[model samples]
Target chain A: MSSVHFDQVYKRYENGHEAMRHVTFQVNRGEFVFITGHSGAGKSTLLKLIMLMERPTRGQIFVDGKNLKSIGSRAMPYFRRSIGVVFQDHQLIPDRTVFDNIALPLIISGYPDKDIGRRVRAALDKVGLLKKENYYPIALSGGEQQRVGIARAVINKPTLLLADEPTGNLDPELSNEIMELFMRFNRAGVTVLIASHDRSLVQALNYRTLQLEHGSLIEEEVVA
Target chain B: MKMASPLDEKAAPSPLPTERHKSFGRGVRNMDVVWRDKINAYLRAHRYELVRSLRTLLSAPFSSVITILVIAIAIFLPIALVIIVNNIQLLGGNWDGRPKMTVYLQLDASENAILTAKQTVLALPGVESVNYIPADQALEEFKRHSGFVDILYELDENPLPAVLVVVPDKIGLSNDGSKVLLRQIETLAIVDSVQYDLGWVHRLNSFMALANRFIVVVTLLFSVGAILVVGNTVRLGIENRRREIIVGKLVGATHSFVRRPFLYLGVWYGLGGGLVAWLMAELGLFALSGPMVELAALYQANFQLQGFGLINSALMLVCSGLLGWLGAWLTVAHHLDEIEPL
Candidate 1:
């Protein structure tokens, strides 16, 4: 069964700007896929559609075997809990410590207090920032902040992980390290989908790739 | 990039918990455990949010104190008014609920005439009892209580007339019974005139009824003012945490989850205000109690100022807390929906 399925999805904004046009694709369960295009190529729009942050003008989206169209606003939060999303801006609360930032998802999910500490520590360890858990986001370096975002996104062990330009602000070395983190999580049986325009980085890690141009799915590369 | 493999046996445990129930009895038992865990988690979440909101309020002591003080002043006015009205009612109650009529005998009324008048008053309907004051006893009693003992005795003759105090029964005082009794007493030949002070009592009672309504009006107006104060404060709070709210929503937080802390903040403000209002009221009553006792003593009456008892104090706190909750709810319901991740 496919983890994400999009059939002839079309998205047009209120001002008549077309964001996604007749986009059709499927990412199978446990698949590691990349969606790459230039800026304004509907990369973010496609990801938003899957997250139900924006509804498609004409299409049906099914995430984890449930039709998103049938899910009302009241059910949106529960639906989002099964999927993890990372932003380019990191979106960390400045007043909170790294530990609190990552433990947010667990708290929202109402995880037991005893389990929260253990899970947060394990997530921080996975991102190699266990010692800096007490530091606020303002004190962290750019790359360190991005890793905190990744840790927070995966803290709940979501079945599907989505990252939008996760390394947009990092140097090439740090970008490669971030990419490696995604690869490790993908190998751990969690499906990973990254929307990035970093061509060389995408080429170095050969895997299934979906290329969008002019809001349409123009090319799809399948890995043997 | 060199790190331990996720598949290594020593790696951190996966976040997911595997399921194991297969038999019917085991499933039911596991369901019970799950329910217990859920309840615990729910309680823990509320406890954490409550503490966190308190910390947030303390972080900005100046603004919070100002907000709470505004609410307290709003609460204090009505409470003070109520106390004033209550004391007035108590002072008036000293006069008694039913009106009394005084029948004045002629200055030269003979002992036989005075006695006949007293007996006639007793025969009238609604005349509960009658006490006759002879002219000689009246003169002496007046000299003792008039505070002009020497001057009252210097008068050429006793100008004061003998008096009969008429108290009406409960049934006679109802409706026009007292009026009829007054007219009958005035018809006696030996009685010079009859005086009924029910007019003064009626005026006092109407004033009390008017003041009672004023308390309700003042309470309602101040309550709205207090609610708006809290609502505006919470509105600013929402603005300050706009980014946090967006991030929380992005991470799968429900609207209620985002709203919890703000609601608690409002409650804290209300409770603090209520506490301050109670203190202000108690202190005002305390400061006034000294003078009040002295004043009541001057009139030879025993009266004590009443303060809000335990039940009323608790009610004030609970009421203010609910007001705070309501204010936060209105602000959050309006503003939180306007905010969404772009």
Candidate 2:
């Protein structure tokens, strides 16, 4: 059973540049998938389309069976709460502490205070930074900051998780560690899709990978 | 397992892949619990949002004070005028002119009869006092006021008649006591006629009424100006927090969520202004109270300065809150659309 569906998706910027052309794919429920391509290969654009950050210019997207076109602006928040996103820059609110950053999604979704505290601590525990709850993002290393972003994304227990080059600024070992964290979530039945152009990190995972070139999907490969 | 084409799937994913079905008996109760919990959680979030907004306002003490002081001074101008006008009306009532009867005596009348008449007039019921003005003094007063001293000096004898001005102890309940007194004084044997000009009295009354109307109109205009002042302040506040609003929108916050903080900031401004206006009005009245009482005593009038009544005070507070909310809403409606999560 698929969790996300993109059919012949195309994205064109206001300046007439088409970031995505005839792109199509699916991430089944409980499936772990990687989207790998060179810079400007439409990887981030695809993740954005899935997150509803950017609407498709000429295509349909179905997340959890609801067509993206049908979701109005007023209902977008409720829809977004069901899917978590982790950005490459670890776009955490700078002034907020680690605990507050992880608790933001749940707060937006209106979780109770006790429930928020429990869930936030649990998420921090998962990211292996339970003791850093009181610390701000600025005080953490790049890898630790990305971990907070990942923890925030999964804090809501969303059905689908999407990350856009989440480890782009991290070292090789830290990149693998972040990939390991994503696999741990995927193994627990959360659908995961990661967009990255890092060649080496994509190799050891042996997950189903979709490769894009320019603005089109050039190949789909699965390790034997 | 061999890999399949990524685009092979033609159907949309199922929204509920792991569905849980239960008996119908628990449906209503389950729904009740779900709705109650949902409402409770949202209420909790609103609590946090409100506190967060308040903290933001308090964090920037200098700018917040400047905004609030601007609003306060705007509100103070109109309120102070309103209170002053109200007290003046009270003083006007106390100084209102009473009807007076002027009795003209025959030129050839006896001095004894005139003296008896003066005594008789003073003894009359509801007659406060009687002043006997001989013809010579009356001529001098007329000459002084008529601005025609040359023509008045040409008179051989004092042509102005001797007059007795009668002040009533109190005006009648029906306001016709002065007229009845006039009729009684006219029957006096030595009196030639009784003269009382009511035109000047009516003019005085209308003047007071017109002054009140003008003050009320001015107060209303200033009130509207206060609203615009608050609106502009809130607009500037929104501009400063533009980035915070964009970030809030990006994180799946609704328009109201993004606007909540600004609305709170505006309320703080309004409340601060209202309180200052109230205090300024009270202090102004206090400063003037001693002098006002002394001035009213000169005319034997019991006058007191009155601040806003409960109803007026409540209206002022309610109006301030609404003005703030309206200003915030108008600004947010226009600016919120320009910012998008993208």
Residue clash pairs of candidate 1:
none
- What docking tier does model 1 reach? acceptable
Report the lDDT tens digits of candidate 2 across residue range A83-142. Answer: 778888887877789998888767666666787899899999998999999999999999
**Residues B259-314 of candidate 2: C-alpha lDDT, one tens digit per residue:** 66667666766777788787877788889889988986665456788998889988
Give the runs in model 1 whose Cα sits over 4 Å from its true position: B1-28, B104-181
Q: lDDT of candidate 1?
A: 0.86
User: Chain B of candidate 1 versus the native chain B: what TM-score?
Assistant: 0.79
Residue B335 in candidate 2 has what lDDT?
A: 70
lDDT of 1 by residue, B1-342 (tens): 112121211101122222212221466786666556556666776888899999999999999999999999998999889888888887788677777777888888899878887988899999899999888888898776555677886899888899998888875576688778878888888989888887787789899999999999999999899999999999999999999999988988877778889999999999999999999999999999999999877765588998878998899889999989888888888899889998
Q: Which residue pairs does candidate 2 place in steric collision? A: none
**DockQ, all candidates in order:** 0.44, 0.29
